[model samples]
Target chain A: MTTKDIGPKNPVEQGVTQVVDFVDERSGVKNSGRWLMFRNIPAGTSWFQTLGFTAMALFGMQAITGIILAMYYKPDPNTAFGSIAHITNEVTWGWMVRGMHKWGASVMIVIVFLHMGRVFIWGAYKYPRELTWVTGAMLLLMTMFMGLTGYLLVWDQKAYWATVVAVNIFASAPILGPYIGDILRAGPEFGPDTLSRFYSIHMLLIPGGIATFIGLHLYFIIRLGISEPPWAKRALRVQRDEEDARRKAARNREAGLKGSVSFPPAWVDDEQEVKR
Target chain B: MKKADKVAYDKDYAAAKKDGKPFFPYAIYKDTIIAGLAILVVIVLAITVRVEMGEPVNPASTDFLPRPDWYFYFAFELLKIFANQNALTPVIMATFMVPNILIILLVIWPFIDRGPERRIWKRPFAMGTAVLVISGLCYLTFLGASTPEGIAKGETLPLTGLDAAASAGEAVYLANGCSSCHMIKGVGAPGPGPELTNEGAKGWDNAKMVQWMKVPVAPMPSFASLPPEDLENLSTFLNGLGTKYK
Candidate 1:
């Protein structure tokens, strides 16, 4: 309304506005974007709340680094190790990318865990946000699985034996264990195909799952709103005032004024507003 | 939470939001700063602690340490604790049971603790679990990090007996990287495998030892791939440890 008279000062500005309006008219994405950016969050949202975003940012970083690495990397068991060596030794700036990818995996795991711990400590998982927490739990597990599958991509002696043992552990799990192991190994044994299987899983399968779960997680977070710090001064003050009012109402009733009193004044007002 | 509790929470949150600010700038700024710092740290680590190329995978050469990445150290350390595989601490406890239980607990924790309380001090159970889990993971990771590798280069076990058969067995053990998991005579990594300093005390025949090697415990890979003679020699070396060779 304020900008009605000032709409698009120049031809270029007018064109830009027209383009945006055209898209907005059809998709309504502009409104949703605006809502997403301008949504009111509790003022006491702590620094710890940044962990989720940081984890997502790390995931983005991983995707970028992974794409670059995948360009020069081979997924075959025989060539996988040699390709890694080529990347590290011959390719220009390849070592840095490999290092970043390697280091990124470790850092991402740390960030993800810290995020989970923050959620756990804040008790932010309660109530309507429970499903958000569940989605987040899925993300955490996927992140760990990402690490597992990614580790095997290097195809080094350590990685190979370690994965063999890890797969063996999975195969040992009772019932579905062998099947899971077979699927992971691409057979009952670790062969040439195991590398490609893990590569697909590390790069495609788990990342897709993570991205999808992250979408669900963010949707929940935005819809339900970020939780206020439970011990925020303002929140505690509100709680205290409510308790005081309830006590006063109780005291008044106990004083034999129950018939005359229009008690629980604020809460009664809230209830009436709800009914209306 | 009950209906009333949920209603109160919504009302309280609405009031908080009414008094709050938009997510942009306020929250975004913090997120950018922390994430940028994290990225910076990762870049620095990449530069300072460059990743190294290791030996190419040779599945036939079971003479490898089989160490996973640092993040997996807690699980690695857990396997060690339950390595002995007695009834009191089955190997499954580490490989399957404990991890599954912890993961299940993590996923369903929100449902389990469906209370209105949020303050850390007020939620003693949650707080206690947090402390215990955090400390336990840190401790296990530390143990994993500090534990000696399977075997140092050129390290030798201190033993007295050296018959040709036992010597061949010891060679098979060392050649196959058994030290990566088991320690013997104060040598080798103290591991996800039992120490074999007095392995002969078990009195297992070489036949039994060879059979176990062919299909060992869950976490241990089968050595059935080894030549029968090598397996027989390893069994002899392992079986005659404390009883005759000490």
Candidate 2:
């Protein structure tokens, strides 16, 4: 009577229904089933799921806190530390945000490492998931670099000496090491210029790169779907075959056995079972 | 067991295979919601939070002490230890060279330690090495932090009886060729040794000074041939210089 009467149905609504129907039809498990209820909720899984959620939550906190920090932070070396002090002293809850950001970085590093370990232990990096593993490794490296660059932008005594030592280490490289070191410092020495360079790279460059890579990483993950345990895969296959047989039997029982429906009709049920 | 029944079973199996479902279903909604929330949180936070700034740096000040940050204190402290010309080259090489080599080794560790086992207990060698290296670094950093500056040079001065020990020590300093490779109060040419202007004031007693001077190694040649009295005079002079020069 509404949009449905003007045409067979609105294309958008039809598309949505088709998608739902497709999922429901493919997965033998009913949408309103008990198992569906459990699967739909977060925290339904074990420790891994909980940890994943926590990491995401922490990242959210960091992003918010980092934005607040960016508003007052001076990229120039001359005023960086003074600005930081002002934020800590004047801004309400600024200290808490800074502390949380700092601690959050440490937590994120640890969690990322744990996540990698989990994937390694489960052999999730095998075959189709190799790209995911490589991307994850890159992410870890980028995150560490982000932390390093961010540390330099603080322009405090601690940051200065740390950069000096770090630059000296870089200069230790065999060939173009000194050049690389100079490039990083934005000159031959650590100064305001170096701080500005690091600040830009930390705030703008690295985050942008990380966000892009994260997009690709997430795309691949969803494309692959959640990996099933070997036992679960076997169970799923067996269950699918049984459901196919049951659907075929029901069709035969409904129509005379003489006029048998094609296996494709039963194939839909198999798809549904697999989805379930 | 009958031939006709078996053929029928084979036919059914082939037909059943054709009827099986597609490999994937379109359940975009669930994952979409998760991704959307993650993006939203990042965007919202990025827009709201602010960064604070600090003071401008001034390079000309002499009183700044110019100490490197805490993390690099170990290296800065290391530079102090090999303050002598003879030890400078090796110390500089070791301080910069060794850590780089270790970092390279760490980057390739996964490939190097490619044993099938993943458990920490199973990977005894790698774990032990990591613990050992980390502990060594911590020890060095702690040692660097604790050791006071200028203790080395003060330990080498003579402590003979002399009223103008500071002036006498200056005389002894010039007589020894220490000035050729060292500087004092920004007067001497740049050489392989650290400056000796504030040696005694920084934390070196007479006893420690004479002992170091008597049996030097590597960079500083031993002055054991010098009479005990002259060495004592030199130590006294150096100790006195700490107060007189400043």
Name the candidate that leads on DockQ.
1
Please provide, for model 2 over B1-246, each residue's C-alpha lDDT reduced to its tens digit, 9 standing for 90 to 100: 234333332343333333432222213333345435544544444335433443334332111122433444445554545555344355445445654565566444444554333334545776677667656666766875564432233334333333665666666665554554355665542333466666667566778889988654323334555667767877876665546554
lDDT, candidate 2, residue B96?
A: 52
Extract clashing residue pairs from model 1: none
Score chain A of each prediction against the true chain A by TM-score and list the results: 0.85, 0.67
In candidate 2, stretches whose alpha carbon ends up further than 4 angstroms from where it belongs are A1-46, A49-57, A228-276, B1-246
DockQ of each: 0.66, 0.05
Best by TM-score: 1
Under CAPRI classification, how is model 2 graded? Answer: incorrect
The per-model lDDT (C-alpha) reads 0.88, 0.55
- Estimate, for each residue in A202-268, the C-alpha lDDT of model 2 and write its tens digit: 8788778777777777667555533332222223233445566787788787788844655664333
Please identify model 1 stretches exceeding 4 Å from their true place. Answer: A1-15, A236-276
| Share of true Cα-Cα contacts across chains kept by each model | 0.80, 0.03
Worst lDDT 10-window in candidate 1 chain A: A267-276
CA error at residue B240 for candidate 2, angstroms: 17
